[model samples]
Target: MQNMSLRLRGLWADRSGLAAVEFAMIFPIMVAMYFGVVEYSSAISVDRKATQVARTLADLTSQSQTIADADLMSFGQAAKAIMTPYPGQPLVSYVTQVYIDSSTGAARVQWSKELVIDGAGNVTISGTAPHTQGTTVTLPSTLSVAKGTFVVWSEISYKYTPAVGYLVSKTGMTFRDVAYTRPRLVLCVTYPTAGFSNCATPL
Candidate 1:
């Protein structure tokens, strides 16, 4: 019994391999943190790319006086290019030309188009009637989209799945961004394919 106690005391006093034991215990946590940092960085990069995608679409579309089906396809390609490095992550976007009515002093959706691209490289375009047409969704008062003028509204949404990050709330974290800009080269832009939308009869 006395030798057993002595052995126990010797074991307690021996500090050999202490650092290795502690490192072994904490190794998993350190790995987790490292992977979390990588995932977090990836998320931030994707979010920023999504934002740039929205802005790029809006900017490119707004520059055009009139947009045809082929032009819109080009814009879609541009958006897809912005997300090139991260393959398989799709980009869903909407481009709406909103009109500020002089008669009603309200902003309404003149024409809207939506596009969805999935991980498998499937592109879905909305063909149904644009519902937001004439919907009274007001714009920010601070900005001035004058009466009889048109502004391009772009919205982008991306679903990011973190590989290993504790900061993520769910498996699919959706990041959304919206931007609006008046036409740079034209008073109004129109989708020529949808209901034959034009500068005068944008529907």
Candidate 2:
């Protein structure tokens, strides 16, 4: 009985594998924390990139007095370039000119362009403006402008997927942002391809 008691005491006092056991218990928690932080940081970065894409599109278009189809295409390409190191396939952007009616204060679409990026990074710009000319568009209340003036509107959307599915969503999350700017050199930006010579031709 004494011998058995001594063996039991020795086993209780032994500390040889304690460190390994503690590590085994804590390693998973540490890894989870690390991945959670990584996923959150990546998502935030992507969201900022999305906002930048929107701002870039609007800023570039507003700086030009007149916009051509080729120019619009170049703007889309610039947006895609801004999203480098991140997948551009899940991005879609639009640039539109909104004109506020002098008499009624209503906002209408002057010219709109749609830019789509495919899964292979192939860019496609609509041959014709997507939104109908003269169609009414709702502007944010904060984006008020003088009557008969014009504002350039840019909208961007991106789907962000985390590197590891364990921490963030496994499928994908969508981030959207919009920016508005007035034309830099002209009262309204015109698109000749859409047939309106100037901003005063009834639309």
Candidate 3:
């Protein structure tokens, strides 16, 4: 028993393999932490880029006084440009002009254009508003338009896929953002060819 005790004491005093053992225990945790940081940072970048995408689309549309099918197509193309370094196909976006009726103080969609991108970032556009056009829909008081006033609302959605996808709870996360602004260049933007009209209709 004394010999066993001496051997244990010698082993306890030996530090030759301490660092290797410590590193063996710590290596996996360090690796996980490193990967976690990289994935989280990448996700944040995509989310913020998504917000900018919505804002840029809205800003571009608001600057235009009129939009046609071709114009809508151009707007969709612009959305892909806004995505920049990010792949655009995973993005879905749309632009709508919300008009407020002076007589009844009701807001409705006047014209809307939506865009879907392909794997190569080319956009396919649909001129229909996702929500009903020329029909009353709820609007935030802040977005409330004055008599005959119009606001352009832009909506965007992005699917973020991580390089190490398993780091997140799901394989990916969906990020969405919406932005609204009054028309910058014209009282009411017109989409005469969008299959819907009556620019000044009140609610």
Candidate 4:
């Protein structure tokens, strides 16, 4: 019985396998934390890219006095290119010209364009504007503009999926951003192809 007790004490004091045992207990948690951080960082990067996409669309459109269908398509392509190093097929972007009423200070859509890239990398520009003409759109309070002026509005959305299902949502997540800018050279950017003679008139 004394020998057995001595062996038991010796085993309790043994430190040779302590590291391995501790490591075995903490390995899974360390791996989980590592994957979680990677997924979180990736999500943040994609979110920033989404914001850049929106800004690019709005900035490019705002700089133009007159925009045609081809110009809008080019802008879409440029916006898609900004997502390089990452799959751009899951991105959706929109460009809209909003006119604020001079008398009532109400904001309404003059013309809108949508760009969509499918999973197969096929690009599509909507034939019909998603936002109806003359429909009211709420602008952010911080985006103050002159009552009679126009603001170029851009929106971007991206669907991001984690490479590993261990940390983030396995199904996926969507990141969206919106940007607004006043027309650079004109009161409003006109969509001539859409049959708008002036910025005040909605097509």
Q: In model 3, where do residues sit more than 4 Å from their true spots?
A: 142-144, 196-203
| lDDT (Cα, tens digit) per residue for candidate 3, span 42-99 | 8888888889889988888788887777776686777777667778878888788777
Q: State each model's CA lDDT, in order.
A: 0.79, 0.87, 0.79, 0.85
Question: What is the lDDT, from 0 to 100, of the residue 153 in candidate 3?
Answer: 88
Q: Specify the highest-lDDT model's number.
A: 2
Clashes of each: 0, 0, 0, 0
Q: Over the full model, what C-alpha lDDT does candidate 4 score relative to the true structure?
A: 0.85
Model 4 residue 117 distance off true place after TM-score fit, in angstroms: 1.2
Candidate 4 clashing pairs?
none
lDDT of 4 at 115: 91
Residue range 1-203, candidate 2, lDDT tens digits: 99999999999999999999999999999999999998998899999999999999999999997878788878888888989989888888988888888899988888888898888887888666767778998898887699978889999989999889778888979999999999898877888986655877648
How many angstroms is residue 114 displaced in model 2 relative to the true structure, after the best TM-score fit?
0.5
| Model 3, C-alpha of 84: deviation from truth (Å) | 3.1
TM-score of each: 0.85, 0.93, 0.89, 0.93
lDDT of 1 by residue, 29-90 (tens): 99888877888889889999899989998999999988876777678778888887775355
Better model by lDDT: candidate 3 vs candidate 4: 4
What is the Cα-based lDDT of residue 85 in candidate 1?
77
